[model samples]
Target chain A: MAKVLMKGNEAFGAAAIKAGCKYFFGYPITPQNEIPEYMSRELPKIGGCFLQAESEIAAINMVYGASGAGVRVMTSSSSPGIALKQEGISYIASCELPCVIINVSRGGPGLGGIQPSQSDYFQNTRGGGNGDYRTPVYAPANLQEVIDMTMDAFDVADQYRIPVIISADGMIGQMMEPIEFKERTGRSLPSKEWAATGTNEEREPNSINSLYIVHEDLEKHNWKLDAKHKLIEENEVQYEMYQMKDAEFVVVAYGTTSRIVKSAIMDMKKEGLNVGLIRPKTLWPYPYKAFDEIPKSTKGILTVEMSTGQMIDDVKIGNNGRFPIHFLGSPGGSVPSPEMIAEKIKNILGGEKK
Target chain B: MKTIFEKTKGLTAKPFHYCPGCTHGIIHRITMEAIEELGMLGKAVGVAPVGCAVFAYEYFNCDSYEAAHGRAPAVATGVKRVHPDSLVFTYQGDGDLAAIGTGEIVQAAHRGEKITTIFVNNAIYGMTGGQMAPTTLIGQKATTAPYGRDEAHAGKPILVSEMMATIPGSAYIERVAVNTPANIRKAKKAIKKAFEIQRDGKGFSMIEVLSTCPTNWGLTPEDSLKWLEENLMPYYKLGVYKTPEGGANNG
Candidate 1:
């Protein structure tokens, strides 16, 4: 396959179409506007439906509806827009509907700025909505990874009967890269026997709902969901270990931050520092096992993120205090340069032993 | 002997969870009856609102989805867009349609979504213990409005059908009440007509049915009917606000 140069947002849209999704409902927000714009132009050509929703709230509900009807559907939005979508996302998760949600996140506590930020790490991994549910979140580092993850997200969503979120920041959403398109294979999706397609006399009416009002019944539903999540955590943890064979220090990072961290690690290696990288591909099922592979000689671990140390907590938890942990972050739309990250890593290596 | 009446097959055997004397039962029956009469029972997909009728999915025999509060219209749009041949309808109450979901409903109609909407206005939020709804009339008492709805503070009740009528995409808009047997017949007729318009792919159609929340209203079912006739009908003004030429098919 020949590599085609494409912008991240356009590649995400194209990947979704290739994943067999036919329904897209989204509202325009900064950095991710190109996604809806691309869908509006391309989806119609493929006989798919693309609707520009009135609001982010409306877009997610539309996804809830289409997913309940047993169709592969998706919606994309940014940080503030994702906040508005929390209510509907909760409904979709509770209903156990299969859908893909893309968060090309921008800086925000509340409309902070329309620049790249990994601030939504907590929001995506902690289940931004009002429930005891989890959305399997994938954070891709580059345009090529974005295409692969966006395409795979639909299958993962269907397999678990849960929502899958592609959490990419504005830099990943706006950047262009060359990528080869490849069809995903070998994942058998379960039959949508529970979908609420209109019923005939031959079959009972199907109701797609999340309302379990009875105390005992609600408890049973929660337990069932917990069991599925346990399976996901066990079977679907993904991470990339770079040069961990004889490392004394491990640098943990993900998304675009991981790319810069990789560059910094290269610079450190040239200076005879024994450092490796553990880049998490899955954020929710947090790849805790990656930390277990660290050699006993490893004295410290550092987590680099675009947010103010959100993923550092996970890194600490993953290592389980076996090693001293440190953090390097640039919050609210600032990207830490490779030199700055290299300096931070050198300081950690030189700092007094914990 | 020939059967003159039987329960509509459009409804399921699942009994409703509504309060005694609540008009939701009647509304549910009539809407399903419309689906049955149109021979759309197998193809009808209903979106249930987040109010007293939140369990509407259990009652409707057709495929159903329970939407988040005020988002039924957007959900219906999704279903209809995916399955264009299917009959999609949203069953929403005042709080779900007139208040919280106002933007979704208005924009759905503005886009001329080919779906039917059954907007039930009972003037109060029944599910959350009778809070003031957007359709709560002046002087209407609600849990949130302990001193009665003040005209100065709450302004006037919203007239959804009249407002929806102004949108170019809305092909048919009607306001009917279900207080009396005669009015019940009219209400069912309007619901059926709205579905028919949707079947013909004639743009958006909505039937705003004036309903009553008896327990919330502090009235018996009988008195609630009288109250609806005396208080709500005058304010809501029951009639067709818009009807496309040669019926909804013209669109």
Candidate 2:
């Protein structure tokens, strides 16, 4: 397919459909309303189902239901809406249902603002709802990456029978960019033999549930889930290393922040400062291994984020206390420009021009 | 020797964990019997709500999804939309349905999703240790309403069947009881009709079964039945509230 200029949210909807997702349930919340609107207008034409739920609580449960039936399903929302969906997401996680959830996060803490923010970093990767469960978080930086990751999310969710969250901010959701969706083929997914589809008497009735009354039984279930989380962490750590050869400083960032950091690296390069970037593509099974590959010439790691240093904790953990970690962030819907980031690096390096 | 009263294959071998004299077991049996009689045992998908019947997925011998509290209707809507040919139903109690899940049930009915809902209204939260529910009768004593359900403070009980009947998308709406053998038979028939309406793809169908929570009500099993007969049946009159010929297809 030829590249077309598409808004990020619309591309997400189209990508999901192309990935054979026939069901979408969501409640409209800003910075992400375009997703549901596009789905409503386009889904029916492709023999897909798009339902605007009564609330975010209802929307995630609807995703649970469809996914429990072994169908490809997805839901998208903003911050407060995602908060409302936490209970159902927890249930979906507990039931081990495979579905894709997109969070085009806006400023938060209480309906803060309808602008781009990565404030939901803790809520997405660290089990937003109750219980000991983790969702594989993918942070996409551009429209094309959003399209590609949105398509891959379904297969990744099914591969592990777990929910995958595409954590994009308002800028990625609202901005328009040229993108092309590549056709996905020959992906092998686990058989949803455990889904609550109708039993044909050839098999026992399937039950998709999370309730375990006995402590021992619940412990067993939790251990099984923990094992899966460990496997995902080991196999699904994805990151991009740009220009690390003989670099003195490494910038750690993801999503839209990484794009800005890339520009900052280019600007810093013009001034004889050599800085590289390690962009984590998967946020939950965070690319901790990338930190181990930091060049010997690296002096410090600079963490850039849209929020006030949410992902820095993981960066510190990955750095293993070997190097000083500097943080530069513009919280509450403020986007740090390339010049601002470049200046922060220069300041951290003692205003050294070289 | 004829095997006339054997257990229905619609239910699993799991024994009921319900309290003695509680009507949840009876409701579950009749609901499953309806599935068995309709030959939908293999083609049925049940959504279990959060309440005493949270483990209803284990008891029903069909593909089941245990839904979060008060979200069974929305879950059932998803299942029915995905598998239109399958028999899909939501089994919810008052706390899970009439109270926290009111919006979900109302919207599901409004959408006229081809699914059935077996609403078990026992008037109190049984699993949560007898808390006051939205369907708790006036003057009904509950943990939350220790002084009795004060109408001035807590408001009157919500009549879910009556409210659901008012929705044009609902194809069949009936309020039944299981206090007596005759009423139990009537409840079974109402359940069967609700499933039949769904099978016909008529629209949303619901049967509100007036049930009892003897343990929560602080009454014996027998007294609970008498209380239901004397108090509940009078307040929640037993009859069909809406029929397909009345307003189901009109919407």
Candidate 3:
């Protein structure tokens, strides 16, 4: 697989096809519509299903059905459309099925704007649906990472028996970069005996369900889900922490915003400010343990985001509120440039001896 | 020599969780019996809905799924398209099939999906404590409609079977009730014929069973059955509403 220049959404779609996802169900939503359009052309060539569902509600439900049959399935949408899928997502989680959902997030409160925004940070990391459920989310910083993260999303969902989301903002979805697709393998997915494929002589009837009617029994079901989430938190936290050695200030950001924060850190360093940055790769089991280990010299942490103060809450939680937290953000499609973020960091660390 | 459970096939060993006298149990038996007689027990996969019948996956012995409220038709369409050889069906209630999932049901039939649906219309939201469903009868009293259903204020109940019969892709559409012995026999026949349409690859099929909700109606099981026979039956007439040979919506 030679390296090729592709937009993030197209790269993500191509990676899923390489990873053995045979079905793609999606509705047209800005920032991610390219994914469905790509699948509509590509999947049929391989004898796979590609449906431009009537709406996001229908699209997600179709994915739910396909995943229930123990196949690799996926759907992509933006913020408002993702909200419509919450009900189906809850049921899919309750049943512990494996699938991928991509949210190329845009600004929101109600059809806020289509420009880049991380306002869905809370929604994506916390499962975005009702009930006590947690779907692990991969926060990709660039187009290449978007492709790699989407492929990893399928593997992790299959391993954990839960949905996995590759959460990118509108900018990440639109940005173009060089991506290398992985080689297809002899490792085909294990035959799904429980799949609803004519119920051949291989196995007896099987059921994939999310309902436990007895009230007491339902509680036990939730407890089992709780146990799975705890296991994920214990094993699946990923991050990249930079220049924490003898630093006085820390900067925390993720996804596309994290890239801007890194550039801001370099500019701040040129100005003789001893600042470091922490970028979370997996937003669910957020890198709390690693973020807490930043040197004792760290006095304050400034968080920069495309949304006003959403991921700042997580940064504070990771720090145990030990360090003072400062937030600088531009909401409703106004993204802060590197200079602006650097200026905010300089203000937060005013006149302190480096 | 066989028990009631054996007489009905394609059902799992898990005990039913539905409340006693809940018409879902009766409907489940009739569908399972039809599958057994048709010898499609091995090839059948049912999609259940959220609500009182949410746990339907446990009762249907074949491979099954429990979909979110009102999206069973979309899910069944997915299952059928993926495994075109399998017989797919969605067992849904009025609240799920008519109210929340109206678009999915209409679109799946409109696309000529080769699947079957067993739509149970009991006139109220049985799972969510007797709220007014989209199919709640005119003048019917429910928890939300405590003052009886007011047509001017609440709008008229939707006749789903009649509505879907307008779609060109729908091969069969029928409405029947199970209040008396005669009506139960008619319902069984209607259900069997609906399944037969899918068996013959005739495209989408549906049978809307006008059912009784004893708990929500605040009546005994016996009284609810009588109410269904006397009042509900007259308005929701029991007969084939549409079919390929004898009715409308033929493509």
Candidate 4:
């Protein structure tokens, strides 16, 4: 395993190529443009394909086409571009085509900012498109997880025959970190039993489409997707919990924000304040069960994010409003300092000083 | 007795979902014949567009993908590039290719992707129950343009073949009609040649088939063909607009 320092977005693109993704269709979007730029240079050398679509909608549709053809394909973009891709993404899921989609989420309700934010938490985990579909979301806290999770993204997508999203923020996209590329197994391209590859003497004509007019037939297809999602939840829910022994306050965060929470946890430990963090690795089958396992002695949960209280809602749902949850963060591209988070922990503990 | 019918191996046996008298059938046969004559039937993949032809996936027996409105070209680029040995083409209606997917189609041709496109221009939306399309003739009456199309209000019909012909990346561009037996023969030849160009790895090639939509035009099957001859052909003139010499692979 050779170690190399690489930016998260670039690493994500390289991992996809290594995983046998032969087509890269995308447009240049901030915080994630490096993915396409990297693909443009690398894909041709490997005898793969790369295209810069006119817009995000076009890009995602191209990905849908390539994926439907029984080849590994992917696209990357920021928040606004991702929003443009929602219609196509929903159709991809409906058709049960396997593909990898990366969203280097930036601050936004509407073209909000190009800075890092966890504002897309609900959007990514909940499928980020029209429909009752869910895309398995991977939230990587560092560069290594970015590489590992991205490679896993293809496996999960193909395993479930559904779209899998790697949800990172602008900070992770831009930051450089050392990562060791792991030798991956199960790297063979999916067979063409259902793919839109031409029907040769080996098989009859196969169509990859999503236009089911009959309500009952459409309903049955959606139900199949639901069952696949249930299977994913049963087998793939993953998270990392830290230093929870006798802790009264638990910090919950994900992606880059979770890394910041780690610094805060260390500071809180030295000050004789018992605090811990629960960093989620998978955002879709969100580690709610892990949060539920928090010690009974814990007083409350502090949810930190780079958005305006978006993920806190999920935290509240997981805790079932069983504890007093406090939210703190700067919305739209502002990263909350470790000091501020640690101070908030001290303040919460000081009032009920032991 | 067999004629070219035996050559259409890539097409399915199922009757098209298009309305009666619609010329999508003619265009489909032409594409199938092209694949057969080029000896690329086993290596060809067709991209089907949305709209009246949204169910086109059911008819093209070759491996096919249904693209969102106006995105067939972009998707074709991905599929063709990934499997460079395969012959790729897209079949789209005016609304799907001209209005919503204008950006994708233009760029695909501009980049000279090694693919063929069969653009069907019926002058009005058929599947969505008669609406104004980008190629809807000026002064033509439809569901959206009840009082006849007004060039001042909604721009003139887009001359798609002519517009794409000017691009340097485009190796061949032609407009044809399926309104009559003679025109149908010419249309078939043009479409077959477009596929031939791509088989040679020549850049982008396109054939716009000016088709008839009887139900949408409020005319009987016979009148729809007559209307296409009289009204549509006058504006979307027939014949080849551009053709590359030697049919050499540019890339």
TM-score of each: 0.97, 0.97, 0.92, 0.95
Provide the interface RMSD of candidate 4 in angstroms, 1 decimal place. 1.4
DockQ: which is higher, 1 or 2? 2
> Which ranges in model 1 have alpha carbons more than 4 Å from their true place?
A352-354, B246-251
Which is better, 2 or 4, measured by DockQ?
Answer: 2
lDDT of 4 by residue, A1-354 (tens): 889999888999888987888789898878898999999989989888888888888888888878877888999988888889998899899889889999999988998888898888877876567777889999999999998998899988888888998999989999999998887776444554788777664677777777779999889988888898899889889899988888889999998988888888888788788888888899888888877779888988999988778778778778997878888877868899999999887787677342
* Number of the predicted model whose TM-score against the real structure is largest: 1
Give the CAPRI class of candidate 4: medium
lDDT of each: 0.90, 0.91, 0.84, 0.86
Q: What is candidate 3's CA lDDT for residue A172?
A: 88
Model 2 chain A poorest ten-residue lDDT run = A345-354
- Model 4: runs farther than 4 Å from truth? A183-192, A350-354, B1-7, B246-251
The predicted structure with the larger TM-score, 1 or 3, is 1
Summing lDDT over every window of 10 consecutive residues in candidate 1 chain A, give the lowest-scoring window: A345-354
Greater-lDDT candidate between 2 and 4: 2
Rank by DockQ, descending? Answer: 2, 1, 4, 3
lDDT of 1 by residue, A1-354 (tens): 899999999999989998889889999999899999999999899899999999999999999989998999999999899988998888888899999999999887887899889999888898679978998999999888888898889989999999999999999988899997775585888999998778755588888888998999999998999999999999888899987868878889999998988888888888888788999999989999988888888878888888888988898889887888888888879898989988887777777444
Clashes of each: 1, 0, 2, 0
Give the clashing pairs for model 4: none
- Candidate numbers, best TM-score first, in rank order: 1, 2, 4, 3
Report the candidate with higher TM-score, 3 versus 4.
Answer: 4
